[model samples]
Target: MTKDSSPTQLTHFDQQGQAHMVDVAAKQDTHRTAIACGVIRMKAETLAIITEGTAKKGDVLGIARIAAIMAAKRTSDLIPLCHPLALTRVHVDFSITTETNTIQCQAQVETVGKTGVEMEALTAVQVGLLTIYDMCKAVDRGMVMSDIRVLEKHGGKSGDWVSLIDQQDHN
Candidate 1:
């Protein structure tokens, strides 16, 4: 490949700068996985409402879990540059921290495809957190979403990559 056609160049644009899908047909399929995380900070009372399962909208975590899975599957529809992928596995997790008055959302997405699933994982985490906000917004509209990021990814030519921030927190 010529230096002009290096993969580092933007993949979502053609020579004319028009938008187009990156062709992955020639790329080898590999087992790809990505994990993303984010947090929603809210009032303590709002957190109590969610924890007690009395938000009037029913179960906050349950609804958020479903939303995250659905969002991961429909990622291509939401993000124009993302490719439609047949995901093999998708998991969404949530934790509530009283100290921070925060709800943390994490999503792990896996697929055997040519492209990475970082976008899918990130989308899932974001949608999951949004669902929480929507369900609890009636009681608390001041909630803030922050630290949305990909925690890790593996497979493809890039191999494995992990976020140092997440690692440090765990340690």
Candidate 2:
């Protein structure tokens, strides 16, 4: 309930009650990269249908990949207070684990900027997962979105981080 208690909330607003972008000008520009991931769990049969191009939607993985890339490019437009960044590269890949009947969506975003690209990486996951859900919903209505999280972030003064999930076997 207090500003000091919530660090995230404290840095998000300004004195006049108007939302403002955090001033990162003083911070040194560094090569930054963020890796984020999420899982879409569903029936094994449904996963097979998608992987085999049997779904009515057509090329589910391709569409999701494009959506993720586009989402990363448009992060600043979608999220207020985020700086527009020129990302050097954005890669979104899906690991279809047949054994688990889950699609692991991973988005890696890189940039040379004052601020980190964690939000961009996260936005890519959200939009990519949504696209997968949209394309496959006709076949599996019970699909669940879970395990959405940042797997790692590197560069900047914070140095490097590897998410807990990555430390554990994704199995």
Candidate 3:
């Protein structure tokens, strides 16, 4: 699709309006990468427990990282219309901000395939935050997850795209 194409165009729908996987067979295989990020905020005390490794559950960040990677690999299985692609790499990282009592999860998913890895990266972030909440819910049930989004994406017919929030940071 070109940049001039209708913004409302839904690639997953056919002329009959039936949901179907977009035909990517004609698309070239390229090195596609997608970076997604999100943050989960909690009480100061809960953050302290996590940072100090005093939570009843073992390492919170470690478990969440593993869950994020697993979620990336199984993205197609979870999302009905996603095409299954062999991911070349899945990297999940977490950063804790004591001042805000928040943990940020970033996932970068890459693949050489007809389509992009945006969905996989996004799935990883969501699952990672969910895992963190699961591990720490006992201590802080009010933990809030926000700012979930694809930071950037590269390759594919549409070419590279970066979220305006990230672009502004570079400038």
Give lDDT: candidate 1, residue 158: 74
Q: Relative to the true structure, how large is the alpha-carbon lDDT of every model?
A: 0.94, 0.90, 0.94
Q: Which ranges of candidate 3 are over 4 A from the true structure?
A: 1-7, 169-171
RMSD (Cα, Å) of model 1:
1.9
Tell how far residue 1 is off in model 1, in angstroms.
9.2
State the lDDT at 61 in candidate 3: 92
Please tell me which model should have the higher lDDT, number 2 or number 3.
3
Total backbone collisions, model 3: 0
Task: Give lDDT for model 2.
Answer: 0.90
lDDT score for residue 101 of model 1: 99
- What lDDT tens digits, residue by residue, belong to model 3 across residues 1-171? 333457489887877888988788778999999999999999999999989999899999999999999999999999999999899999999999998999999999999999999999999999999999999999899999999999999998789999998788899
lDDT of 1: 0.94
